[model samples]
Every structure is written in C-alpha cells, then in structure tokens.
Target: MNIPCPYCQHPITPGATTCPGCGTSLLREATPQSAEPTCGYHPRRLSLAICDRCGTFACAECLRLNSRQEVVCQRCHALEQDTPLPWDLREELGTFTAWWKTVVAVMFHPDTFPTFRPEGSAGESLLFAVLCAVPTSIVGGLSYMGFLSFVPYLLSSGNPSRDSVPSWLGPAMFVAIMILGPLLSAAYTVIQAGLDHLVLKMGGVTRGFQVTLRANAFSQAPWLLGAVPCIGPYVAPVWGLVARVFAYRGLHRTSWGVALAGCLVTPLLSCCLCGGIYLSLIRTLGGFN
Candidate 1:
C-alpha cells in the first residue's frame, strides 16, 4: 500500500522515509530544549506520533503504518507487521462474520495473503482451524446418528438379533462425533502444519512455525463446504490442499516450488507409505490363503 506525501501529494511506497517527487524530508528536527517530545531513535527529531507497539516517540521518518494500519516505529513494525486478518479483528467484526470473511478471503482472494503478516499465535490459528472443522464435524455426526437410527429398522425386518445393538450406543456415538471430531480435526491441523513447517524449514523458510500453522488453518477455508452432506467431506480436503499451496507461498514470501513442497511433501509421503503398507498386507494375506 502507498501513502501520500503531505507536501507534494506524491504517493510514497510503504516504509519509505523520503518523498521522491518533492525531495522533502519527512522527518522534522525538534527545537533545542523544547518541551516537545523527540523521537526515540533520533533525539534531534520531533515526534510525529507514538509507536503503537513499543509506545515510544517516533518521527515521521521512523513511523510506518503496518499491515494492521496501526502506526508503529520502524523497529517494531519490522518485528511484527501484525498483518490484519479479519479473524484477528473479531472484537470489531464479530466472531462469525470475521470467520466468514476470512474464509472467503482464503478461498477466493488468496493473493491477499502476501499482505498478511506471517506472525500469529498458535492458539489463534487453532481456533480458526476448529471453526473451519465445525460444520463438517456436525454434519458427519448427524449423518452417523441418522444411519445408526436407520440401522435398527433395516435389521429388524429380516433378523431377530437386532436387539444386539445397544440403546446407549447411538447417543454416545453422537457425542463423540459432534464434540470430539472437530477438536480432533483441530489437533490434526496443528500436527499437519508442524510437519509442513518442517518441510518449509528444509526448503529454507526462516519464519517461525506459527506462520505455517496460520497458513494451514486459513487454507481449511474450503472445509466449510463439508456442510454439504456426503460429497462435501471428499471435496474439502482436495480443495484445502490447493489452498494450502497458495497460503504457504503467499504468507511465507517464498518461491512457488518451496510452497508446494511444504504443503505437498508430507501428504504425498503418507499416501505412498499407506499404499505400500496396504499392498504388503494384501500379499501376506494371499500367501496365508
């Protein structure tokens, strides 16, 4: 994003201290021994604003609006851009709306991720993953519950052993599916993201694990489709994987190849391992026969 130079109205690039068109100095010198506060970094310069992150006096040259649109000192801004995700502004946007907007952005406007700060807490990302898991988990649980209820009717028509299905089983399954499923999905999201981060590290990512975790969580935006009954569950994972590639690349400011490796390597390896194990099991069983 560009900001206008107050003097010439020239659009200045982000983090620039000098105006190109006007050749004007953005920083102003504080009068000697004046009551006005001087910049923290430059004692001779007057403060234009206080840094939001460090709460220190900052001159125009030392201040920049971060991705969150908060004015912070260049030093603090460099450390935490706090790229504004709608989900992070839940207090203002409200929870569900923030989540929906973030999902839409992740699914449709993935290019926007480059503007997002790669810094976020694991707790925040996990909460997002859990929210993304909710619709599918609830739908799956309800579907299972319905199937369980239907099973008794189907078995009763031709069998006398139908009473073998316990009465408490349906409710227990419902609780487990509805309550535990989303939580498990969130846990899996964290684990999968951690594995992806390891791949990113191999590919030369310098950012912390939280960056990968947040990317993974945001990529789960496609999982909202899991509310659509049977096909939703199948579609979500595939769509999410595609989104994950974009998320990793955009957030990490990495090459597309590195992003793809980070998102795909672990999953591909898992699939290959599982396939090999299955083939081995089948061969062993055939030999026994």
Candidate 2:
C-alpha cells in the first residue's frame, strides 16, 4: 500500500516520511495566510492524506499505516492494532507450515478472525485459494481416474476386448481430468469470490474487495476434506459455505444475515439454474423415447 506524494503525485513507500521522487518533506508547515487544508490536529501543519477510518485530514506526522495497510489518523490507528494471520507471516513460519496453520485456524477457530489482520494482498489471497483448490481438484480427479481404470474390468466381464471401454480412453480421460481439474477450480474460486464480493458490497460493506477476497479464500479451508476418500468432495461444498459465512461476518464486521446472504445466494441461484436445465433435458429425452 504505497501512498502517493501530495507534492508530486509520485508513489511513496508506506511509512515513508519523505518523497524520494522530488525529495520533498512530507511534513511541510502550513503558511499562516495560505488557503491550504490543514491537519485536523495541527492547524499550522499541511494535511497529507485523509484518514481511511475517520475521514479526517491528517498531516504526515499524524498519519500512519494501520495493521490492514490502510492510511489512518493517529487516533484511529491507536484504536485498533490487529495481529497478523499465520498466512501473513509466511517468511517466519515457512510457507507450507504457515498455510497449514491458517487452514486449521480458519476451519476450526474462525471466531478469531475479528482479531486477526483483515487485509492481505490480492496475490496472497489468490494463492491461498489456489492452494485450497488444488488438493480438492487432484483428489477428485484421482477418484475419477480410478473409476475409469476399473471400467474395463466391469464392462468386459472377464473378456479383454469385447464390450469393454477403449484401452486408450482411460488414460486419455485421466490426462484430461488431471490437466483441467485444477484450472477449473482456480477459475471457480476467482469467479465465485467476485460474486460474493458484489453481494457484500450490496449489503453495505465499506471494506475493499481484497478484504472480501481474503475472507472468501480463507473460507475454503474446509476444502481440505477432499483428502477423505468417498465422502470428502460431497461434504466439502456444504462445509465450505458454512466457513464462508463465518469469514464474511467476522472479517467484514457485518451482521450474520448479510454474511449468510453474501455466501449463499450465488450458490443457490446456480443450483436452481442447473436443476432447471437438467429437468428440461430429461423431459426432452423422454419425449423422444
């Protein structure tokens, strides 16, 4: 979260007091007669940026980046100091270890989300989502490949070549599923997260999209259930929705109703549409028969 220099509109690093672009001091004093906006706390100092939390003008000396990477006034910053999630401490915890801790925490201890930092970079959130998605995709693909591998045995009934699935078909299907499963999962995660963010916005959430994205991604912790053989994929979707609702409520500081609606509405609509299409196709095929 880089701040733009008030003097030159050049991007400055967060917490930087001086602009490297123009070598200008961020804490310039306001002139007595000039008609420039002054800091809410110090009338003699020029305002550098408006506080994201309080919406008050603040001077460089009064402004600081909060735990969420938002530029806020000193008073607002002092009001909240959140602890970072394990995912945010990847360098210290090691990437895989941090991700595993975050998954467990999100899946079992979601109540702590309100106390953890709400903001993570968009890339970080997406990476978490992809990580969650990959395992489920791979497991589901493996299950399908296993079924395909057994198809010849079942269809052939002791005959190798007659009434059996093509020898190459199983491997072909395996290759296709292995390649497409993770890609589709990643796409679904992005699209569904975007839809959830829109619903959260409609529910009057003032937080940025990255916050919603982070919540949505972390909510997928339950997807780890895919490791369980037969029932994992079936159970993961319902559990994921439950986790999503909690994530939305805790991270966005919104009501349970808003969070539930945000997490459930898109999925429900999709189910209805698919169900309708399936019924129509069945009816058409029956008429042909």
Candidate 3:
C-alpha cells in the first residue's frame, strides 16, 4: 500500500513512523487500500504531493526533493532554478520622485510640513539642509542687495551724506554678502545632495542615500565655477543644466527627452518669478515716494 510522510511530503512505506528521505513523521494509522496509487509520503491515501514552490501536485514517486528536503515536483524545481528575481523599474522611479517632492514641500512650507524618514537616517540630514537653505537664501539675497545696512545708518547721530548710495550701507552690504554668499551656496549644495539621496531611495534603488548624495555632490563640483567673476554668468546655466540632468536621472531612473525641456523651463520660470517680484517692489516703492 502507498503511504506518504505528512511533514516533508516525501514518500514512506506503509506503517512507517518516519520518512527515510525527508525525516517527516508518517501517519500512525494505515490508509484504506485502493486500486489507485496513493501518495507515498501521505498515509491518508492522497493522490499527490503538492510542490511547495509552485503548488503542483505529484504522487510520492513523482516528488523530487531538494537540499531543503521540501517536496517539489520536477517542473517546479527546474523553473525555480531558471527564474530570475523580480525587478520593478516603475516602483523605483516612484520612490525617488516622491522623495524630491517631499524635499520641495518641506522647503516651501516647513512650518506646516512634517518630515518623514522613510530612508532612515537620511531624514535628519534632509531637515538640516532645508533649515539652513531657506533662511540663508532669503537673508543672503537681502544682505547682498544692501537692505540691512539701513538699520545702523538710521541710528547714526549725523544726517546722511550726499553720496548716491550710503557709505556705511555699501560696506555693510559687502560684508554681509561676502560672509553669507558662500554660506548660502554651501547650504544649497548640502540640501540638494539630501534631495538627491531621497530621489535614489524612492526609485527602489537599495543603495544608501548618503552614498548617492556624495556621488552626486562630487559630479556637480563644477557648480563651484560660479565663484569666478567674468565667467560666473555662463556657469549658472551650465549648473542649471547639470541640475536638471541629475533630477531626470534620479527621478525617472532612465534618460528621456523631457529632461532637456526641464533644463530650459526651470530657469526661465525662476527668472520670471524674480522679475515679477522686482516689479512689484519697484511699484510699491514708487508709490511711497
């Protein structure tokens, strides 16, 4: 009579306590006799053993065992060996794209926004970068334009000099710009690196965000070319192009023609916004005058 061990689904002799092949305990009671072949591993007189991997049913004699001693049919074992692991490119892209969106959201609205540490320790770095960049950018720009110097000038005992621009204002603004400009740049670079890391993580890429951020930072070292005097204007466009390229690569996990479109559009949009603000401020000042 055919019998099968219940544990490992391997075949065993009738009335056996354990399976010789898989060490699974056999049924204590003997199964009813039948003309049809019963599973050698199951004493319940079942027709087949189910393959653990692919769920194929096979008689005890048909079962092929593996190193794990789990019963698997021949076809399943062969397919298991041949099949490759699953990869989801779209899931990867979603993850990175989500991360950058998070960074932008936090940057523009930190007071109301909350930080999420989906990529573990990276959340802290991202938060630090944002905290530094926003304030630095605003304050640094104002200082570069000499707005803050008016405070000390107003407090001075003597009346203002005849110079078109105030003497103290130029020196104060220069000091603020010199001190704050590089600091703002550094903060922006750091924030950008964090955002890049978040992008890589979102793309379902298992690589650490810190590693990706470091690599991107190194690749973008050319952004420092903005430090040059006559050459600085040209450097901004190049840096913008590089930023768009990196954004595309990190967000989509693949190259596409739209990346060039982003390069062209982003700078133009920023300029328009800045021009609008400048015009509004000029009108307000003129109304007061």
Quote each prediction's TM-score: 0.72, 0.73, 0.31
Candidate 3 backbone collisions, by pair = 3-40, 4-40, 4-41, 4-42, 5-41, 11-41, 92-203, 95-202, 96-202, 96-203
- Estimate, for each residue in 171-258, the C-alpha lDDT of model 1 and write its tens digit: 7788898789778988899899989999999999888898999999999999999898678879988889889999999889899999
Off by over 4 Å in 1: 1-83, 159-162
Model 2: per-residue lDDT, tens digit, 1-289?
6678977999876456789899898888998999988999988888888898889998877888876678888888876777788999999999899999999999889888877777778888878877887676666667677787788788677676754566677667767876676667667777888898898899999888888889988998888897677898799888888888888998888999999999988988899999999999999999999
Backbone-clash count (model 1): 1
Report the lDDT tens digits of candidate 3 across residue range 1-289: 2345666656564334458978754423335765544544554545455676567545544566653456676665554342110111225546445445433433333222111111223333333333323333444555555654555465553765545456567566766665665566556555655555454444454545554443333233343344445675486447545554554444334343443443345456668999999999999999999
Residue 270 deviation, candidate 3, in Å? Answer: 2.8
Candidate ranking (TM-score, best to worst): 2, 1, 3
Q: Please tell me which predicted candidate would have the highest TM-score against the true structure.
A: 2
Residue 67 local lDDT, model 1: 66
Candidate 3 residue runs with Cα over 4 Å from true position: 1-182, 190-219, 243-247, 250-252, 261-266, 283-289
Poorest 10 consecutive residues of model 2 by lDDT? 158-167
Model 2 CA deviation exceeding 4 Å by range: 1-50, 57-62, 67-70, 155-157, 162-172, 276-289
**Residue 97 lDDT in candidate 1:** 94
Model-by-model lDDT, in order?
0.85, 0.83, 0.47
